[model samples]
Target chain A: MRGIFSDGPRTALTAFYWAFLLYLLLPLTLMMAMSFKDASFVAFPIGNWTLDWYGKVMQDKQFLDACLYSVMIAAASMVAATTLGTWIAMLIVAEGIRGRMIIFALACLPAVVPGMISAISLRIFISTIDMPTGTAAIILGHTVHAVPFVVVMALTRLRSMPGNLVDAARDLGADNVVAFFRVTLPYLGPALLGGMIFCVLLSIDDFVRTFFLGGYRPTLPMLIFAKVQGGMSPEINAMATIVLVVTAAVGLYAEYMTRRARTR
Target chain B: MEPVVQFDQINKSYGKHVAVDNLNLSIEGGKFVTLLGPSGCGKSTSLRMLGGFETPTSGRILLSGKDVTRVPPNKRNVNIVFQDYALFPHMNVAKNIAFGLELKGLDNQRIHRRVSELLELVQLQDYAHRLPAELSGGQRQRVALMRALAPDPDVLLLDEPLSALDAKLRQQMQIELKAIQEKTGKTFMFVTHDQEEALTMSDTIVVMNKGRIEQMGDPDTLYGRPGSVFVANFIGETNLLRSTVLGVEGDTASLNWNGITITANQGGLTPKPGEHLYVVLRPESIHCSVTEPATGNRIKGKIRQRVFKGNHTSLSVDVGDGTLLNALVHPSDVAQLSGEDIWVGWKAETSTVIPDRQAHN
Candidate 1:
């Protein structure tokens, strides 16, 4: 009792950190656990465990199509966001342009703006252009929302890098392009990888952006949102479980790679 | 000798602040020239201009008699080892050395050979596989040097390359750098604030002050014949006494410093009587004795304090007019004068007179 009370504030802070962690992970953990429930309905404290919901979700044609469309759209968005973000970061940092801070702030504004606001604005803007509202619209919205984050992350990494390395390479007979490729790009490797991974996950996890823009085809997030609104189901639990597992794996991999890079 | 690099009235300014002002200099081929100055004196700026990292605002830079003012750094046949060494963190020592060769599109075998040879030259043959973080500061500096020299550039620019090393390592590297420059015979333009480093390593030293060249000459000439009071005070420790020229006799001049009369050898500059002047005396040149020497300017003073250095002892002698003159005596001779009345004197040749036209008041 004395030990517990003597370290009261520190113990409280440690408890608070663990509580925050639990709060963050609770919904996903509950969804994963419910996915293995034998019952048809999703609920707490499963009496039995089974893979029937996983089988059902896999067998459903609509779910399968939505899964395919989500994968394709997310992959396309990830590629576009990463490429555009990396180019913009390099331009702002390495090119020594005027008003760099302003440009950087503008580039990062999309990520800080509310996703629903961005989605609605983008939806109205794209509608005036008479563009389709399916995978293309979803991809556009996700890319816009995710690219800013990628740019910010990439720019932070690029700015921390020693500019003298590039200058050294130039002094060593390397042309601008050669120096960038041989020196700058290689040094940006881990940051680029981490940015790409985060961009992909952000694209996949985004629901508000996909909701307004996804026309006929449903992204995984949109489908999940719809399923959750219609009431809990074992199939939705199974899908959420898969997403949680994949996101955790990717996050762990990114953390590992970034740490390894820092050691180097 | 023909000039390998020349700056013709080069001037650089940012907005209204002048960094290098109408600077003109020429470097002969196969000579080691050091730009020596204190911080903010524009020596580094001059080196950067030579390396094509900076462009003169209103003048031209020439290399081997060809105009290269607008040439890019990569196109210029000059390489620079930055002050921080700037080794690629991702690359191993061998790869770092070979980076320049690879940029030149050199063949693989030749790149390998050159890298191995340079590794041997810098005495880092066994550490080729280690990353820069794994190596010590001096080893990283060597790798940077090897990388800069791998392309066999016509000129090498070193921006205080040894400034980052420890004292012992810096001393060792000073010798190593001189040896390397001699072997390669590349026109080396180095910049440093260290007086000893500049004097020990440079074939010629260009002293700069306030964005302009103060003087440029061989180390001996620069040390012996400083053109201005700033140069005289900067290059070595000198006691610059404010004096007034009383009269001139042939090449020697009689000067009065606060009513004390002294004589010094006059260079070509002749000052009229009552003109303000400075009598520059090196500490080692001033001798302290219990009795005045037979023939030279002598001043009676009392020892204010004594500092015991390793090989010599320095004494602060107060010559009664709110002025303290420093005299260095050999440790063997220190026993003769400690807190005692003594006569401090220097030969006329050992002292030079600098007119107070732009001298610090």
Candidate 2:
């Protein structure tokens, strides 16, 4: 047993880790490589490579409009989700709150439920309420999907926070409203920022909900899906590559910001 | 002048358990008072009630002769240096100190001036720009103190603020805290479980037990003349010798021990003839000798154990019937008591008598 648990590296674990990494990166690498292919079709064994597909993707008015449209929806949903989620998180973590466990479970239910199921239910609910299917419906749907992530992140931060901070604020002559804005909200800054960014990323890539709720105007994912039905092309790969790079960069920046805030 | 703070028949109960029971206390201005007790002794609860953190079930709390029972904590002119310091992590030391002043609607210039002056109070002027997370423990403590003092509150409440520091730091902070109290001349209501800390810092100490005040007086009075067995044991190390009172003189009582007759002070307690009592004998008051001295109360016993405590040697002498009386002696006295038999003695004025309630049953 000591020999098996020795300080030396385990070859089997190393092999399995590399295999997992390769499996995860292989498809992403292919898609990126195909974006640079000169051929119009997205097939292997490309004879030539060029930047023409990227140039065309950049010039496409429909792609640009779709990008802007998706961003606006993500922003709207993020704002609503963050505000509502932070309030719910605070309610759950507060003292003398009855049935906290049940409240937390319900708050986090959207995150655990299947996206397809949530999308279908949201569609039916919106129709029942006589809400038109457009930016409002898509934002409503995205906000519901985004809320649980915000709640979970904000809840984790709130639990680790010392209760004394608020007490100290009150002792120093701050009323409830002032104390929340001055002390509690500032303390929850990093968590809320991370959660908002996560909401944006989640809303941007959410296909099922947008597909179900969207009307005439198509988002980036919807536009990409429409283009894919026509034919798989290097232009589509270029569009996907741009989105992948941008989202990955945003996610990384959020991670860096949270880490910096934590250390500070 | 009236008292700075007063608690009138306060009682705080949580569900079925009473935390503080009918507590009435008046704290004078410019005095450092400490509520000292073990955990669950209601010391903290009483302080919280005074600070407007906890409302009493039935009572009124007055601040400088104003009824503040229903007032919120922010409305009260009382500030607390919380046990954890509770400095805002996002705010710098200067900003943390300026928080209360800003809320008072002080202009930026005065707030800055006041914050810097407070920083100089703890000699942390250079650390004004530093965040709380960047500060050392003692520095953070000073910042917390300065923050509480910034608003010139009528009363300052400290809840075991020094308990988190190391031994040396705690001792240093104790002196600093007392000095700050003297300098500011603010009524300080400190709550702590450390008896030594209370004795060192408090102008007046209120000893609490079981949700009630056990005794309240100056430190010397509480230590030298404890009213009950709990106060006697809790304030300092002492041995309680169960005895029956044979006779009583003015301010003195003759007690009959297991087989020895001893005389002790009444300690303001009146007892009649044939009454059961316990004589509270401080260990430091007892002297150990090889032979019985010609004066004071003397008892013969065998030396059961000896512990060398650097400054003095602590001896546990078994005085028959399984009763071990502890006595502190000089290291030189231990060599002379090598024999089996030893005489432990203390003056009659040094020991006090208390009625043993179990005898009534």
Candidate 3:
């Protein structure tokens, strides 16, 4: 059994998989290397490694303020997206709402349609109403991209729920409200949590939408974009590496959670 | 006493296709009744309606003389043990059983006592701390049963609850379930496609076909004297031959089979002369012999095949024109057959007459 599980052919395939991983992570690896450069500019090879860039990043007030604004926007969007996504998923899947296929298609549009289109539309709408396009507008725009993921994940979990679990709960003297909390909510916890994590990851790194809607103040991603425009510096590389590391951790955890939930 | 559940003229339809058509049934309290049928025959639908998971398109359902047709499942007096158990995946066995009691807002001590008693009833006392996924299939089934029984609901509706188990475990649980039903004295409204399961556990068996009740009776009455061709075919293995009615004499009818006329009882049914008729004979009722039988409808035919069952040998004799007369002879008696050709016979009292006065699509 062990031989059949990971034979020579399978080991070869695993090698290929690691190669693909290397291809994906090569740019981030370069950025991490450049972050420790003693040189003023972010580039490849040589030079002495130092923490001076990290020191500069820590002391930059504007960059730190942008980081705070990005955190606020991402946190607010994560909460809103998770709540709406979970409830809307339940409404479509469990509530037996009519026209479900249409609703499902519509719910998935924000995810499938181009993010640039959504950003442009949201920016237009906000400016048309004379609303400020700084943190609030950026948060709204990011939610549009993040919510579709949450909705899809929650719906996937809810759809695979055993048919009679809710029925059994009700039969056991639980009303619909209690049944949801007792049976359905427990099954949905991992999926909803994964969805929230994805939302956080996407919101924190979101560049397209935040670029469009950041009126006077810049988010972390917008600040990184401005730094790149001014030519790559060690401080910019340091900040990018930090963001990359956090997002990668979140993304991996979310993947693991959703997969485990599915298997169970 | 009022019936525990009464479905009056219930009809359920999915789009244009009827699921349960004009179903009327009343289940007595403290009796184990099974709704047995083929797939898509509305047995599960009927059970669902009683459990309030399904609302009939028309008609009312009364629980203990109180109408509950439009009530949600939680408000109804019944609970269900689903086919796959439907045990809460997250909760341990004890918590699963206590859920209903918790919903009723019972004190913790009372809930624990009720859960413990239910576990004991299901003979799963040691499995209280195990989650549903941790237990085996039969153990999961017991936990599911205990969960439904915890609240002591008036009616316990089980929809093919033993279907997920292996054959041996299913048989074991059948006896266990019947014993539990008797001990609790709760109305057990079970639904299953397995006739043997229904016969083993039910005090009353309601056989359904094509979204309608074909026959409802005790196992003895249903197997010994099936009312219609559908019921006779569904309940057990039986030889059904379409025949031409020669005439009717009292409660018995004479039908012409493959070049012979046989008399069969109408089984308390009266039909018009110009109607379709069928002869229903259980395989065991037909006795095979090398020599001619002393009396009754005896036909000579050559043996086509022999199935050597452990307890008995089943032989099918071809009586010409594509008609095969099957007989289940005892293993000891099968040795006495002398040649390929033999006599297949049954008493007139054993043959059942299924008459259809109206044509059906």
* All candidates: TM-score of chain A: 0.91, 0.95, 0.87
Model 2 docking grade = high
The fraction of correct interface contacts reproduced by each prediction comes to 0.95, 0.83, 0.93
**Clashing residue pairs, backbone N/CA/C < 3 A, model 1:** none
TM-score of 3: 0.88
Residues B143-184 of candidate 1 have per-residue lDDT tens digits of: 888889999988899999998899999999999999999998
Which DockQ values do the candidates obtain, in the order shown? 0.78, 0.84, 0.66
The DockQ assigned to candidate 2 is 0.84
| Ranking 2 against 3 by TM-score, winner | 2
Models ranked on lDDT: 2, 1, 3
Candidate whose DockQ is highest: 2
How would you encode candidate 2's per-residue C-alpha lDDT over A1-264 as one tens digit per residue? 567558357867887899999999999999999999988778889889899999999999999999999999999999999999999999998889999999888988999899999999998999999998999999999998889899999999998899889989998899999999999999999999999999999999999999999998999999999999999999999999999999999999999999999889
Local accuracy of candidate 2 as per-residue lDDT tens digits, B111-136: 99999888888899999899999999
When summed lDDT is taken over every stretch of 10 residues in candidate 2 chain A, the lowest stretch is A1-10
Candidate 3 lDDT, tens digit per residue, B1-361? 8898998999999999999999999989999999999999999988898898889999999999999999999888788999888888888999998988898899999998888887877678898888788899988888888888888788998989888888999999999999989988889999999999989999999999989999899998899788887788888899887777777888778778766878777777664564567788999999998889999888889998999999998898998875887789898898887479899989878987776534454
Worst 10 residues of 1 chain A by lDDT: A214-223
At residue A64, candidate 3 shows an lDDT of 91
